[model samples]
Target chain A: MSGRGPSNYMHIGHLVIFEFVKWLQDELDAEVYIPLSDDEKYVFGKVKSLKQAYVYAIDNALDLIALGFKKGKTFFFVSTRLSEIYELSVTLSRYLTFNTVRATFGLEGEGVNSGVVFYAAVQAAHILLPTAKKGLLVLVPIAMDQDPYMRLTRDIALKAGFRKPAAIYSKYISGLTREPMSASKPETSVFLIDNEEEVRKKIWSAFTGGRPTIEEQRKLGGNPDICVVYEWLKVFVFKDLKNMNEHAYKCRSGELLCGECKRMLADALIKRLAKHKARKRQALRVIDHFFLHEVEIPSEIIKILE
Target chain B: MSGRGPSNYMHIGHLVIFEFVKWLQDELDAEVYIPLSDDEKYVFGKVKSLKQAYVYAIDNALDLIALGFKKGKTFFFVSTRLSEIYELSVTLSRYLTFNTVRATFGLEGEGVNSGVVFYAAVQAAHILLPTAKKGLLVLVPIAMDQDPYMRLTRDIALKAGFRKPAAIYSKYISGLTREPMSASKPETSVFLIDNEEEVRKKIWSAFTGGRPTIEEQRKLGGNPDICVVYEWLKVFVFKDLKNMNEHAYKCRSGELLCGECKRMLADALIKRLAKHKARKRQALRVIDHFFLHEVEIPSEIIKILE
Candidate 1:
């Protein structure tokens, strides 16, 4: 249940996931431990210095706290402080052989770095951290591409005598180019810090299949199914069944145009994520308190305990 | 400078190397950090349980403390508590490729375990942990067979951007059968707990190159160079150079017989190692103190801090 630091502005991908985690805490009676995975950012991210990584991790942690996660329900910690987890990682690595890891990852010849290979074991150890033995069902919601790592983790868990984790696979949110949205490519995705104008311009320039001429549109019909902007609406907004169905059918019939669809989806997305952004601002200001202090064990959790 | 647990009695091989470490500390002004590597013992050694390893590590730590390591000057800690070092080990491993490690250690396919490969990085990390910014000149005194690991560690240090370690290699002391003495082979090695009578009996049963008759030995000289008992005297006893050279030539010239040579070497070895055995006895009683505290940066260390 750990999150990475928001070194770059919090993008739509992060917002969607954190919101889902928050929903799980409120409805599913889950006791969540959110680790700010600053260590990963330090090693993988573009931050050239350790000091920069620390600052970036702190900034990202603030953004996460602002996303309205209840202090009592969530336990937030930085990865650097948890040395016990690293020791456990070494123990886990010792039990797994190199051939087994290579087969699991599909790595061939010299393509894999030792860091990437051992990183799978480190991730597996994270799931079995002492805090994870709370007897609650563990659920990890990550992008579909990251499934290989989670699958490897499940295999390692069986050997280590720990329970396997259940996962929720979410599809990637695409960018203006209709390619997978990456935080590194800021222009393609809307960040939490993006203002109203930037959000509008990105949507306006977004790749769509609709034509300008009425004859061409009628002949071809706008393929709303292939449009990245339309998919964004389905994932982020227009959750109502009747409204979504009507929009999809109308767009396919050439009754609705690309410009109209883009503007409507943009408006809905901004409205849907606005509350989270405001909270993110507040979270950043008081981050020191949230990260350093232990929160109360919620009454609901205690009742389940009793 | 991590020490092994003392609950299991140390053999002569352990004594020889430990004595060398003591000499280095006295003459080289070395600041020794002894990690009671109980975690390693639990994972790899005969101890099947963590509880056993914990107890054993404590016992051994006390034994090492009694060997005259200054309390403030020499720091001792358990491997489990020193998570920072383990984390650094993981980081160091990333910089080292498998090819480089395999080449350095002369490991072939299936020849190396993941732990064995990772341990070299851990050993390198151990040498660098005390000083992060500045380099250090580490000296490791071990048996000749262990030279490969030290050599690998030195190469890893160069690649990992740390200080190189210098090694002082000592040859193994052979058993009564003229084979390398091993703790696993108890009859061949005299433990610290061995009584005087047992020591005398073992020496008496020891193999020698002595002839059947003194008359035959006077004409045909004993092979002092090939004799295990004679070599023990040259390596472990007879500190005075003049007397040792005189005895070596005399033995070769048929001046000293094998029976007399065994008694003299055994007496010198027993007398020389007497203090270590006494200290080991006192160590076993107070082994509890070694595991009582955590490793902290001492004031003196901080004064010359990285």
Candidate 2:
């Protein structure tokens, strides 16, 4: 349970991942550690300063908490607050050679900053947080694009005599434009923080699989395969197989209009966003309940100060 | 007043630099900071673990304190012990881009680990430590090899709206074999921690400008220009120009034999080492006297963690 600090508001894509993590935690009956890398946000130039990243981290953490993860079991830590993470990061970095990280991150022969190169270790520290107390069966729930980071962490953990964490990768949720959902381009994403009005506006302008005219749509059935709304329904909005099947059938038969489908999505999202906003407000009050202190400092690290 | 943690013992080369720093502090009536980058030593593969490097840092600090620096004015900090330094290090790291640092350090397309890459930022933090309180004239007494780091620090500091530090470069004291003294290769350097026996042995085998045969050296004068002993005398032992001139004349005229000169150096070093040992013992008793707490955290950084 780790993510780089958000410089912008998180989109629905992040919400999907957080929901998945909560499910995994419940299934495995395991503790969750969420390390917010605010330092990385500044170091990587994603934010103007650490203060901005810190605000993002707090805002993002509130969103995660709003998803209703177990309070005592789930712990969130900011990278800047815990110096031990950086120390451990330095330790974990030793297991990875420059050549290996360069190749792994596709930075070979490229001008990657030292902070970016070193970020792998900090990320690895978050993944191996469970190993500090004692080795445990670990599972990293992440998106497919994060597979490389998981692989690197597994390699370093194994080398350091810790259990290698298993990864379960989820498919990416596409933007309304049929591209990857990104927070940087706010217009492309339906953010969890957006109000009902904003959600409806975005959905109204969203790309769809409808024909130019009603007669044309009736003659040539809509192609749900190319529809962002249909993809979103399959991945997140519509979880019931029977309901999803009916929606797909209606689209193929030209019985379901694109406007109606978009309106349905907007309504569902508006209700969901309202619920999320209330929970987020509650989460802000009890955010400290899930905060974690410094991890157990290793004896080797203790010896350093002595 | 900052140097990377010593993986091995402090050589005479380091002693020269420390003496110069002490001189500057006395002349300027200023505070001194000595940051031992134990984290970097491990990151750069100079030591096996942070523990090893930490021990080395302590030993090196003892050596510096033994040089009789003002107890209250001189501050020593290890990278692992100080969280504030890590925070400042992360802040400074952002000002440098990958292209600039890589080009400056000649790490472009090279296999340099993240620890090594990030180390430059930590080094820069030490350089800019004075800026935390108020802008003041800063003089970094460093060897010529470290000029690149100073330049990088200056560039970053100026951009960050801090006073640029001034650097005064020192000529390196060569190894007994007439090469640059390095802690990695113990045999090449006469360490401050070396015992009388080891000192005698190294000096006995030291490279000199003496001829192969004593009879040949009497006919053809010995070249003090290439003599390690003459260099040592000029730099450390015989500070007086008149005494150095006489020693050089004696060497050039073949009046002083290499063996006698070696014995003289050995005796001088043995006495100096003994004095250093006593002060080191005293330094260990009051190590806490020179320990520095976190420098005043800037409002910008405070806001980050707030």
Candidate 3:
């Protein structure tokens, strides 16, 4: 249920993950705990100052809040301020060795920082936090990139006398340009904070699997397989394959033009983002409601060491 | 200023370091800060449980207090209990990369654990704790084994806009058997808690420079240079070169018997340890006075980041 603390504003890519988490919570009647790793971002060299990272944590939390999570059911914490979690991280770090982390992360050399190495333990703490309740089935909805961390968490959690928390992996949602979505590349992704005009502009210039010429596209047909806009529709707009199959069929048969697809996505994104923008404004007003005062370790887990 | 947390009972080997630390505090009028790294010991696989490490910390602290460090000028903390230190460690851990720690610690292939690797940051936090006050000169008196950590601490402290801590290195005091003193080889070391009978037995079996036969020793003189008794006498009992020279001369001339030298050292040690033992019992009654509630991060250091 935890998400990485964004060093910058989160884009639509992050929104998709939050949406899935919300769905899981509604379906299973689950509670979510999100730890904001501002300390981590500073240690990872992502932000120059801890204050800057702290601000990002707040902004990112607000973004999640704007996604319409139930206030009482969701809790957020910043790592540096949470001493209990840091202490737990120390305990978890002991269960793992340097070779295991290096092997798990493919960081067998000089580039990794001690902070980054220690962060694996902090991440593991997040995974096992719910197990304090014992028999609480925890389902982590994460992107495919986080699978390695999940594997490490599962291994260490079992060793520390906790149930193996399950990980539900999802694919990476590509950028508007069909490249990896990164905060550093502003043009490639649609930010949650992007205005209607900005969203339209980004989608209009996005990468699509259409032909170079309009006449060629009509004769040879267009392809939606590699289209970022189509992928967005498949992940966010359509819930069933029936409508998705129709869209793809029409796209491949040249009945749906690239411009028409782009217009449809842009309109839907604008409508969705406008509602999210309003919710974000509301979230900023009640930011304090979502933060956890302190993280509680389960007495059952504490008794193991005792 | 920074001392490692003791993992087991403090032996006579640790007394030498305490004596020097007491001398430095008096000579330089310096404040002493010692962090008990029970976490480090657990991470290093020295102790099975943190509770065991915690008990070692209490016993070790009593030993240090027995050496006569003034309460007002001294402070002690266990790493697991100090959240401020853990926070500071995260800040410092980010300044250097994994390659830096690996290169500094000679951890080429990585049999080391994550806790031990992260402890480098925890250790660094201890070094820089005093810099909260502007322009404080920190003098760390440690054995040769800790030089690598001191070097890393100094580098990170300077980079973090603080004074580079100065280290005063001392040689390791060998065991009675002439090997490095370790808790693993309990027979080789004289524990502070050892009774008079135990001390006498250990000393009586200790290595010396005397020849196998009295007739051989009378013809070819004993070599005091390789004698453990002479080394102990040189390091602990006798400070003056004149007195040391007389002892060596007596051994070389075959004027001193191995039995006589062992008896002399045992008596001196038993007397010294008895006094230390009495003070240690008294120290346990006032252990709380030496613990720091929270290590204050100096306003000057905070301003640098601000």
User: Mind giving the per-residue lDDT tens digits that candidate 3 earns over B1-306?
Assistant: 858665777788887887899998888778899888877888877888766777777777777988889888898887777766777888888777777887887774776668778888888888787774445678898888899999999899888888898998888877899888888888788887788899999988888888999988877889998888888888879979999999899899988888888888889989998888778778766777888754333243233222
Clashing pairs in 2: none
Ranking by lDDT: 3, 2, 1
Which model is ahead, 2 or 3, in terms of lDDT? 3
Q: Give the Å error, residue A257, model 1.
A: 6.5
List ranges where model 3 is wrong by over 4 Å.
A39-44, A49-51, A65-75, A80-104, A108-114, A132-137, A158-162, A195-306, B66-73, B80-122, B132-135, B155-162, B207-289, B292-306
**What is the lDDT of every predicted structure here?**
0.64, 0.78, 0.80
i-RMS, each model, one decimal: 3.6, 2.0, 1.7
| DockQ-superior candidate, 1 or 2 | 2
Compare candidates 1 and 3 on TM-score and give the better one: 1
TM-score of 2: 0.77
Q: How would the candidate models be sorted by DockQ, starting from the highest? A: 3, 2, 1
TM-score of the A-chain for all models: 0.81, 0.91, 0.90
Top candidate (DockQ): 3
Give me the runs in candidate 2 sitting further than 4 Å from their true place: A39-45, A88-109, A155-163, A204-275, A285-306, B68-75, B80-109, B112-114, B132-137, B156-162, B176-179, B184-189, B200-268, B285-306
lDDT of 1 by residue, B1-306 (tens): 534532254666566666677777888777776665544554443555444555555545544666676545566666555656655665566566666666666766633435545555666666566555334566666667656667766766777677777777776777877877866677686765566677777777777777778998888878766777776776677778897789878887898888798788678667755776667566554444443354332233222211
lDDT of 1 by residue, A182-262 (tens): 778877888766778888888898888787787877777788777887888777777688877888888888888888988
Residues B1-306, model 2: lDDT tens digits: 556465766887788888888888889878888888878788878888876776677777878988888988888887866766766778887776666777788974656667777778878888887675446567888878888899999998987778888888888777988877777777777887788889999999888999999998888879998999888768768969999999989888889899988988889888888888888777776777887743222243223222
Q: Using TM-score as the measure, which candidate wins?
A: 2
